[model samples]
Target: MTLLGDAAHPMVPRFGQGAGQAIEDGFALAVLLEHAKRDKIPARLKAYQELRLERTSRV
Candidate 1:
């Protein structure tokens, strides 16, 4: 399984991004998985990772 938010990118709590990032992760993952078939789950998850990685890194 893949990880999200702090589980994927742990960071200091001073900026308070933990919960926000987790919510963002959940929404993004949900969108990617919404229409995915069993055979497409891997691709959807990878897409979610790529998108979130870029986004969270920049935040």
Candidate 2:
């Protein structure tokens, strides 16, 4: 249901961040999903997007 890294924000290979961002996404997802409640999934994903979107946009 949630996309990460290239799936969320594809970039040129010149950036050299596809893999790194994917790892970061995975890490963040793990933390956000830990003991997450069904009702809170949306908020958790929103938090993930907020955390990553800004950084990826700058990159």
Candidate 3:
């Protein structure tokens, strides 16, 4: 399953990009998920983590 919107990234909620970025992440995750089934959960999650980490680290 993929999490999206504010449900995924609960940021300051003032940047206005939280929802937008979450949607972007959802789409990206969907593309990643389509490439692999549940077997790719680890990798998919890793990708999400990488993205979130990168974004958060930038903050």
Instruction: State the lDDT of candidate 2 residue by residue for 1-59, as single tens digits.
Output: 79998999998897578888899899999999899999999999999999998888977
CA shift at 48, candidate 1, in angstroms? Answer: 0.6
Total residue pair clashes for candidate 2: 0
Give the Cα lDDT of each candidate.
0.88, 0.90, 0.70
Clashes of each: 0, 0, 0
Ranking by lDDT: 2, 1, 3
Residue 37 miss distance in model 1 (angstroms) = 0.7
Better of 1 and 2 by lDDT: 2
TM-scores, each model vs. reference: 0.90, 0.88, 0.61
Worst 10 residues of 1 by lDDT: 10-19
Q: Which stretches of candidate 1 lie over 4 Å from their true place?
A: none
lDDT of 3 at 14: 86
Residue 41 CA displacement from its true place in model 2, Å: 0.7
- Residue pairs with colliding backbones in model 1 are none
Q: What is the lDDT of residue 18 in candidate 1?
A: 78
- CA RMSD of each candidate after superposition: 1.0, 1.2, 2.4
